[model samples]
Target chain A: MEAIKDKKNLQVVINAGWCKSCGICIDLCPKGALGRDNRDKAVWQYPDKCIRCGLCELRCPDLAITLQEAEEEE
Target chain B: MPVKRYLRQRFFPQLWCAGCGHGQIMASLIRAIEELGLQKNNVVVVSGIGCSSRMPGYLDFHTLHTLHGRALAFATGVKMGRPELNVIVPMGDGDASAIGGNHLIHAARRNINITAIVMNNNIYGMTGGQSSPTTPVAAKSTTAPLGNIDPAFDLVELAKGAGASFVARSTTYHSKEMQNMFVKAINHKGFSFVEVLTQCPTYYGRKNEGVSPTEMMKKFATTTTSIGSPKKKENPELIERGVFVDQERTEYASSYCEMINQMRKQK
Candidate 1:
């Protein structure tokens, strides 16, 4: 199972297995929300800075990255 | 962008190599479709055999994974049968230029309303890195160990000369540019063609000594000037990437449909 973090309705999931750490998304992120961890996998380095622009989600070559609004917790 | 709505999550992660540019191209395509708000039911994605051909399977749309190098022919039939569907073909360099070269030109000449996105990765990735028609003269491939002597085919120029109404070029390094080109090509009515430079990091980058995949991709940005740039004149080796040709022309399906209607009326 993949780790899905709910950062205030921002559901972000990083499938580390498929990630090749190309740094394309990391370089293109307008908000500087993503960075490589010790394992060389893409992680949400600045979750608070996430503007939900979808640039990383749309540009990820591996599809290892996913970003979506959290479901309403009503 | 609700990309998950259009992508098949069952096939969650694609099979492309980590640094492979195909996935980026695929993402741009999906974004373009979403931006245009084209429904999956009405948009038909067609592809020929190659690593790139696998795109349609992951995309949630009316797709046809056809024979090797025969995607244009298959797309032609689809447009003729159902002229309303937006047919988009994602072909590889070998798929578009080698075996399917003839069909490519004829489709352009007929001015079919299919937006053909040829992902020019230079080498045949699926076939274990053989030299393709678009491979540079000095590039080393499995088949060309001594460095290829053949001249590369300029796909953009080929499409323009073949009478395609819309022609453009962009590398996978430029994701936004690629998506924008797709938007314009889809908006264009007749034989729209875009040659996207996709890097096959596994196969295309192996033999080149001291050249990292990142460096190679950056070369696309530095080497190419847009169509109207005066810098294009300064550097002949620079690939001029932009919408080179766009003009009003009658689309194949509409014209054919009109002819069929005329015949029926006479009868």
Candidate 2:
């Protein structure tokens, strides 16, 4: 189990291929971290604002989104 | 500059229980609000009677510490009246699923825009160790001297079935996870319910195992499992304890707002 230490590094990744563009993740994100991109995929715009609440991942209808502790290199 | 931070609850302590999980739950709520950067003035904490329901007295934000079993009813009014503000209801097991069960079910069915955090300690610690609606069967409580004959109500499943848009469950010992779930519940646009399986060690514990609050928390840590992903098959009882449900349904508040907008446009 990977523990999340610094919440700022937390990032939400949406697999565009699997995404149905249902926008459930967008609506469920408490920090307003997600928005629709040009391709209609849920994009992480305000990544810093994310508290890694995991609501997006949990509420994703297609399970297309994943929350990961962003690599330190990033 | 905007206020650096505002105390969501008033500084004074209202809950009297020693090592009660209600205070921790309240603190998690306040931290979640701060993490979301929600203005304290725009957040309202509504509660009902019970040792846990006294949470509103400590919050600095707009609060309504109402009569027993009516927190949800009043919260509905608050959300309907001030749709802009964040409405959060912090309640005890008996206050939420027992006497207040009707309001709770309807609120979920209506998909009202309110976040209800149910602090389920099994027994009603407030009025002594009475068996609450969520008290597990065979659990020893003051009211059930021999043992509880009634089966416990799985609040998460009930809320999900009653039409809650989002439902999650966590424990007081898992503070970080509880905070995360709470943040999600608050941010959700529709009716969101989170069942916090807490410990009433002083009352429930003394009756059951004569253990301290810390020991009871250890039991919670051991007995419960995360919701979506079962930790392991070894403890079937502990499995299914984390974020059980998280999906979007038609939001009652936003849908109503849209309907009003369309009606005005038609006129």
Candidate 3:
């Protein structure tokens, strides 16, 4: 997670405002690609590891974390 | 973002409590429909009064927000009237088992082709945390001053025994399994029932177990086992998850149609 200074392709968008920080997505992430940040918001700790399985996307009750194509080109 | 296509975006910020699992059930239902490539217009979500019943208000579909604990009856009418449409009813524990208990039994007995998702949070969350039919013995609730003394209904067993053609149980923590079950329930031909366990952190958890949402979810993850797992024999406390009953039977609506046709021919 510390190595994820610059996130790349396939970003996980966490609508932190509605999130309960329940960690269902974190536990369901097949690649262990997500973790909660200091703000208790779900963040793609290692986006590179994500396989776009969408387990987190389909299962989140809050609709908090949605898988999206990386928004930024960087 | 894609799932937004199935939601009524104008209804953003649902009224459910922050940690309520209704949102997860909604997401899973949407994903299941998406996976099945179902047309939104062809799907009808019928719900009764309760926190989970509010799902139809947010989802973009032909919906009926009906009386408390009467969703199955209304859904039965809708399905019988238009057999082509997919009718899905979302009910809370009290809504399904307590007030509408007779309807639940009759619906299963008739084997009407409809899907019923019982969101069993075990407490009447919207009504100030009174113990519901699914509330386990010894659980504390507003109505259960000291502790709940009455035994809870084993919903899966009840559905199976009552003649549901398809029955399954899964929890909010196990999203993948739940989504698969929802899809299966929808696809099944006869009356399909899926009981989804959810965490009522605002009510049940706080008052009964005093655990946070994450803690409650973890408890579900650890306490549950697959229906066929050998661990079930050793740990009787483990709630078994997965499909319990699946059988092919002539659906009531179709049979009624055929009966009418036969009578017309005889005349």
Candidate 4:
């Protein structure tokens, strides 16, 4: 179970170092895939809910979020 | 290539205040360059002194951080010196319209092959929230303690009046639209001017009733409409955002070369 969860985490990566906790991504997200962590940074709280729509990635002003391509696993 | 490849990773956590729209503009620009498959070496990003001017430093492309309001001037020189290279100038509202207003008009009049992206944040973010030429009437700023009485310059009209071949406008809320506009402007052969209505949340927002960046972006989405939308007919006051002018013209660099070639033939 832990291995599967770790593998799924690679789908949407967020760089906390670059993130400024602006909340643009969370507010603009269509799927509500992102939520604020304890530190007020964005995190993929519900990875299953994400459709990989890339809106969060596109709308992130900080360039902290990157939606990995699904084909990369092949 | 990925958009990350075009960025200088060392500059992460940019100097802009949280939710400042300039970062979104930069992101759109990088995505546009990537979509166009432009060579990094062939591109030059130039900027004048302001919050928006800091963009060139973050990008990995050939960049020039020039004097205040003189980005277009320096970009003109770069374009003329190497006609094949793509030159992009990102400027702040004050940097473009107030101090560099003359250069802006002249650059457009010359029909030079350069892309100018004016990140219009209404106030001078770098200078402690002073009113700029594009600040809306009745908007309060540090300089305008009561309310700004002066009418703002319509940048789209101004660019068209100055003879820019490509003129467009988009707000930060419409990031996708902005990216597409950037692609089109960069592909244009003559002078291309794109005005992006960004937000200076820290200074401009706090001065005017303490509006946050999210609220500012929401206002942009509600107050602006696309060109030729029926809503615009119903409400003329709604600011129209889209490509205003796109036409082929004899580019300045090409015309100069042709003149030189004709003179050489006569000699």
Candidate 5:
């Protein structure tokens, strides 16, 4: 459940277990920030390219993708 | 709590087909329930027989998977028996409009406190892709190989005509809007009917345009417009999406209680 932290202080987490690789999120991502992993699961491939619009999180049919604010480091 | 907590964890990687719109609807529904901050134990998810009816099984709320087209009937009983509980019924197109149409209208007429979501995927995906009541004219299905000649039922109009206190329409492609509509529908005091246009890529898509799930979803975005939008005026063919009716009315359960109290007072 560890989230992938990008430079913009946002966490893009994709639950691999539930992802069916439907490609909806990948196809709908306006910035092409999402890409398929070796297992064909969606991954935050280009973290820098994400605009934090949350479209991927909103339209993910599988409920596998999530965007959250990165926790502040002590 | 996270949205995942509202779901039955053991049911992860749900049985729905990949890219099926039911998952999206389920996700939106869970999000709506979470946003409303409703107690999970106090909510009930009732469903009838169909691919869409399987939603209750994955949700963590008190759920009842009932007989075909009888979800509304069972939901009525549940609401009457436990007036305080929030009853939400998710039904398939055929389940709500065909087999259960009577229950649906009666529930609406009674103005019962319940939220009914009609997942209108057009074709019945579960029973080998047969044409349902909402299947459009000239649409191809297993039961309509030469293209269906039957006209589709206008669910929103039907619910409005049945006197539902709240009525709305949203497609799976409009998940954000759908979630908001779900919130409003649940909060509505009387019977609320929300018809969600979903896609059955396996059956409807293959038999018709042979499009993928993503394409079907994209089509939804293009074909639907907000209620009273100028786009609809220009192109009458576009499906209108949004709340068509939202009026306050005396809820059935409360009225029944008041009647019982009045009789007791006379005694």
Candidate 6:
């Protein structure tokens, strides 16, 4: 049951190659779950804080990000 | 339990396609409502037919899903009947500036106490991608197979000319800015209009030159410059976007109510 909850945890995947770093996703994130990666690319700095708002995924200029709620491992 | 509960239409998943900007706009609206600390009972969300019109159903409030292009008309009635309620009309480009154009103009003209949030995805998303009055000239659509020839209506200018008490424009990509605008609109005492330039990834994507919703959002973010100056009149492209206008003037309902009260006192 714990594994399932962990699996279902929300995660944001960022493809740095496609990221434009416009900061739109960063600004719009209601929970402040995102921040810049090592290369100044947008990343999910704190995945646990994600509310799965999808603003980052939706506003990513380069289609570089995807958001998924991890499924629980039963 | 929290004082505010979710009252929007749950049956309808985010109606717009994946990556569509409408979702962001909807989220911004909900956030704005929460930020304002409004009681759900005192707020009513009304909508007309179109993608954006589906908004009222999803919000947990007194919702009215009315006829196409007539949201403002119905909202006016709601506001008049219950002057204390915060009435909000969320509509699409076609529903607001096209089929419902007349109502939109008159509502602003009347300065009715309602917040009109026009989600402008440019083309009509529902009922196929038809060219709307706000579709940029030469932009392709399902109906406009070879690019639209008609000039688009500048809603900000139109609202200003029509005498709206508060008028502003922001794109869905600008979530924080758009949220701030919504907050202002709700707080304003009179007719407040906000045109949110959104993205229709499915229909509008294949039709227009833009590819994805993200690209469209980036275009909106880059192409439009701030209305603030350095006041150098750059090329027309630079002047296309941003908060073009904001003004505080007489609100219709308050003034009208005052007049009626004075007359009653005199009698």
Please report the candidate that would top TM-score against the real structure.
5
**Candidate 1 C-alpha lDDT tens digits along B1-267:** 566788887886788876778998888998899999987899999999999999999999999999999999999999999999999999999999998999999999999999999999899999899999999999999999989999999999899999999999998778888899999999999999999997787888876543555666767788877887889788887888878899989988999999999999999
Say which prediction, candidate 3 or candidate 6, comes out ahead on TM-score. 3
Worst 10 residues of 5 chain B by lDDT: B1-10
The predicted structure with the larger TM-score, 1 or 5, is: 5
Candidate 5, residue B113: lDDT: 95
Candidate 1 Cα misplacement greater than 4 A, ranges = A1-13, A27-33, A46-55, A67-74, B209-212
TM-score of 5: 0.95
State each model's CA lDDT, in order: 0.87, 0.77, 0.89, 0.91, 0.92, 0.77
Q: Which one is best on DockQ?
A: 5
Better of 1 and 6 by lDDT: 1
Per-residue lDDT over A6-25 for candidate 3, one digit per residue giving the tens place of the 0 to 100 score: 33345678777767676768
True contacts kept of each: 0.51, 0.00, 0.57, 0.49, 0.63, 0.04
The reply for model 4, stretches above 4 Å from the true place, is A1-10, A70-74
Query: Residue by residue across B1-267, what tens digits does model 4's lDDT show?
Result: 177898898988888888899999999999999999999999999999999999999999999999999999999999988999999999998999999999999999999999999999899999899899998999999999999999999988999999999999999999899999999999999999999998888988988858767788888998999999999989899999999999999899999989999999999
Better of 2 and 6 by TM-score: 6
Per residue, candidate 5 scores C-alpha lDDT tens digits across B1-267 of: 277889898988888887889999999999899899999999999999999999999999999999999999999999989999999999999999999999999999999999999999999999889999999999989999998999899999999999999999999989889999999999999999999999888888889978778899999999999988999988999999999999999999999989999999999
Alpha-carbon DockQ of candidate 4: 0.53
Interface CA RMSD, all predictions: 2.4, 17.6, 2.6, 1.5, 1.5, 9.1
Q: How close is every model to the real structure, measured as TM-score?
A: 0.90, 0.74, 0.91, 0.94, 0.95, 0.77
For residue B152, give model 3's deviation from the true position in Å: 0.8
**Where in model 3 is the C-alpha error above 4 Å?**
A1-8, A20-55, A72-74
Indicate the docking level reached by candidate 1.
Answer: acceptable
Which lDDT value does model 6 have at B235?
A: 56
How does candidate 6 score on lDDT?
0.77
Q: Which has the better TM-score: candidate 2, or candidate 5?
A: 5
Clashing pairs in 4: none
Give one digit per residue, the lDDT tens place, for model 6 in B164-226.
888888887677788889999999888899988888877887776556555677777676666
Q: What are the DockQ scores of the candidates, in order?
A: 0.40, 0.02, 0.46, 0.53, 0.60, 0.09
Q: How should the candidates be ordered by TM-score, best one leading?
A: 5, 4, 3, 1, 6, 2
